[model samples]
Target chain A: MPVETIDRSATDMKAEAAQVSADIDAFFDGLLTPVQDGRERLFAAMRHAALGGGKRLRPLLTVAASRLFAIDRDRALRVGGAIEAIHVYSLIHDDLPCMDDAELRRGKPTVHTVFGEADAVLAGDSLHALAFEILADPATHEDPWVRSDLVLELARAAGTSGMAGGQMMDLAAEGQALDLPAITRLQQLKTGALIEYAVEAACIMAKLPADARTPYRGYARNVGLAFQIADDLIDHNGDTAAAGKPTGRDAEAGKATFVSLLGEDRARQQAQMLIEQAIEHLADHGDEADLLRGIAQYAVARNH
Target chain B: MPVETIDRSATDMKAEAAQVSADIDAFFDGLLTPVQDGRERLFAAMRHAALGGGKRLRPLLTVAASRLFAIDRDRALRVGGAIEAIHVYSLIHDDLPCMDDAELRRGKPTVHTVFGEADAVLAGDSLHALAFEILADPATHEDPWVRSDLVLELARAAGTSGMAGGQMMDLAAEGQALDLPAITRLQQLKTGALIEYAVEAACIMAKLPADARTPYRGYARNVGLAFQIADDLIDHNGDTAAAGKPTGRDAEAGKATFVSLLGEDRARQQAQMLIEQAIEHLADHGDEADLLRGIAQYAVARNH
Candidate 1:
């Protein structure tokens, strides 16, 4: 039987987002259950980082996209959980003393601050491994080919040529005069790659042909860039609590970002244009893709 | 046709080790080739950490074990390369200022020391992702099940239940006395887990039945323990240059280890017995198992 499709209305978008958030929470709770006679502290740190707080946007994107193909919601949730693990691990490491040097995240103490730098590092590392482990398990998909595809795409999205590489560029960009293209490229890798993978994951799960996935890929690309631009706007606006991190750090570090390069008005306009383009890509699909369209709008509108 | 079996002579062990080392070097060279107009620094850091240096013992173990089932040498080499990537990434993170805080590794500056700590962290992160990516590729194995199996096992071995857990235990062991069993369990998870996975990967590649893999698993468990004991002994003896990193740190940290829990005499005796037991596990096999047996002996005998 085909999975139930969600409508594209604002109410459905809110409901879908909440549903994925709860599913992710439950999944992580079960996954991170205490290992008796094991490294309890490590598990604790992992729980703190992974389950502490987040909007679960990547997971929502995965489920929403999967809905278009009538893919199993449970499988989509698992893949989303894996992607979220990678995202949380990245944040944990990024908050380390030697990295972002931030003391707070999601309105809570950073992993390193709460668990010590060493434990935090190990926690992030373990989470990274856990993500791949989750995807490789047969439970993720009956077909080994799909499981391998998920792992392969995730690794590409998260590895040196992707998110990690983007981070390297971000670090290198510090105090350097970067043009719009350089900054665009940096965001594409640092944050965009994983976002793209989340959408692509659904295509893989649905076994959609390459041609069939192009629109979703395009949608993801636009959403990813717009998300980053909105993030820059948020930082420039200095709404610290809403951002869940210190605002104005980008400007403080003399780092060039969308808001800094183009005036705030232009940057905001660019983000809106990207979001329109993002929604346009999903026009071929009916109301089954409504949630995905809703999510693209949410990505730009979200304050935190 | 069955793959050629390696002989058990001392000369053959040396030759096999060198051959695997060369194969891994070539594989990583091709994998880490420069990306044009991309994050060159991150790639450089990855190359420095991965191709910098090591005994390639894990890869050799992978190759030797694969030989038992007459698996393809090139396929075995690719699997070995993936394992080596995991090993190198672990070492890179282990040497971080917040972890081991070591300046030198493999007779050269550690990743964190050469590249800034942030870059080093990202480099390690990227390498870890690259390992899974390599295993998930179709080129690694024609069977998707085999690829997923490799990914799953490696993740389990490297994640919180294994290496990361052990590292956490090690950190927690500081300034606290641990019993022999506790220390043994720690090493088992940390180093032993990956070594065991290296052997198990061959079983997966060969599509051997579970029962057929028992002896190899036993062999791996014993060899893994012996390898750790030897490392403890080397550290106890203050052989810094041979170890390629500072030795005697365990003693300085007041940490319990195989050598500390059991005096040097008993520790050496234990390692020797373990190696013998390891080799004995392969008694049911013919000359096809020679290299694995040789490796067990080398694990205890190697200075580094």
Candidate 2:
């Protein structure tokens, strides 16, 4: 349960995670060319927001999950890129003046700060729409039911009841006490929902049996919670340079967090326990889930 | 072309439009119940925003355009509801304090004003996502190619380079005399893009031939322009009671418009011409295009 025993040096896993993240970037960069001349400017903004830096966790989760179904890299990458686009769009909108109002994200001025809020907002809206557009593309030739379910899953994940609703709760809970239950609910909705979507959609896209999907969903939900709690711990304990943004933001904002409510020691313990539970859900899938299991463990143990 | 001679009484047409609008509402109302109890509240927000009210122009455009292919009322109505959801989402976001800052939409308080800005923003975001979710539903069993293309069209119409892009231009161009071309581009991007999407999406959903989509797109673009110009004119000359909102908002905001740039008489003349051109594009399609033709004409002629 000790942090030192489980914590992996950021440098140890940084190379591979960074590679996966780059693969995601490259995948999206290839799709961004305008099919028509008039589309030039819009495509440029799409690239600008998309190519911006991040951990690429959601997309990575997607690719890893797809791999479990024995889908090849190319197909996984396309769907992964699409999920990342949605993730990027969410970040852009979250940074808007009316939302989180952060001036920085991914070690640079956020999209709104660079592009102006209206463009940032529109970029987010457009990119979110484009996610479904890409998923439903005829080139993918995914089954109609699969495509429909993907759209439905994503809409629910990103919608008012999903990430945004979680955001509302976070905002309302700011400067207030959030107990373990409230914290679980908040993180589950906000971050866990999308992560669950990424994993489950990958399973759905690969046409995995319903049995495979059910457990994968559980695995994903647990990993998502662990990932968020780790974020809270890091935000409290991480160095600003290593963390890529200011640390202790939650503390400064007086936001309710597992760390704040449960103490850093207990929070880290809970994260590990959740990660273990997550990996256990994938046991029936065997080594096909190794990357997913690796990432789940990494979620809690990574330094930044 | 005489303004006085045009039968300006849109009540009967409005009543008919309202019935179609009601059908669109009923479709979504019956369809959006969440499977999970926790999700139903958010789903209710989605339904509330979609069903609450609007001019229903976008849905009307969808139904009218699809009728051009054939009166496949079921598909047309579903697509119509989907398009209306997108339009409503845009309005909800556009009216936010960070955006247009309007107090009233469709004669009632804006969504953000009633729901709180955060919920309103999420509601809009969800609505945008849900638009695709609805369009891509398995129950609809729409062709994958058609659904994909429709998704793309909708994305492009809503994205940064389309409606969102135009909004940014308007924000930046406040108090400036955007040249005639600039004015056209702004309106086209801000309003025309989605209007085009509505019309084109309907045609695509109907499985119309590719070549046929071109004229419909043209018709949509033209009516989109006329609609904005007429909106400007109404903001100048229409009655507040008839319009169901305040008159003269554009002028008060120092926003550029066709009516503001040219004289009122010229704006009216231009709107008439655009509607005529919109109608002309439907020439080969004949009486099946009547609803579309009538709506375009009504767009310019309506007091509201």
Q: Which candidate is the best by TM-score?
A: 1
Name the candidate that leads on lDDT.
1
Contacts from the true interface found in each model, as a fraction, amount to: 0.84, 0.45
Candidate 1 A-chain TM-score: 0.96
lDDT (Cα, tens digit) per residue for candidate 2, span A1-304: 2454234323333555677788877877776665342334456666777884888888778877877778766666767777888888888877777677787677777777776665676677778877876777655445656666676678778765577667767766766777788789878877888999989888877777778588889999889998988988889999877777678888888777888888989988998899889878877775566678768878987777
List the candidate 2 regions with Cα displacement exceeding 4 Å: A1-16, A27-49, A140-145, A252-254, A285-287, B1-12, B27-49, B252-254, B285-287
* lDDT score, candidate 1, position A58: 97
Best-performing candidate as measured by DockQ = 1
| Residue B287 local lDDT, model 2 | 51
Candidate 1 lDDT, A1-304, residue by residue in tens: 1224423356699998888888998999999987755488899999998884888889999999999999999999999999999999999998888888998898888998988998899999999999999999999999999999999999999998789999988887777999999989999899999999999999999988889899999999999999999889888885878888899998899999999899999998999999889888887788788888778777777787
Superposition error at B17 for model 2 (Å): 0.5
Instruction: State each model's CA lDDT, in order.
Output: 0.89, 0.75
* TM-scores of the models, in the order given: 0.96, 0.87
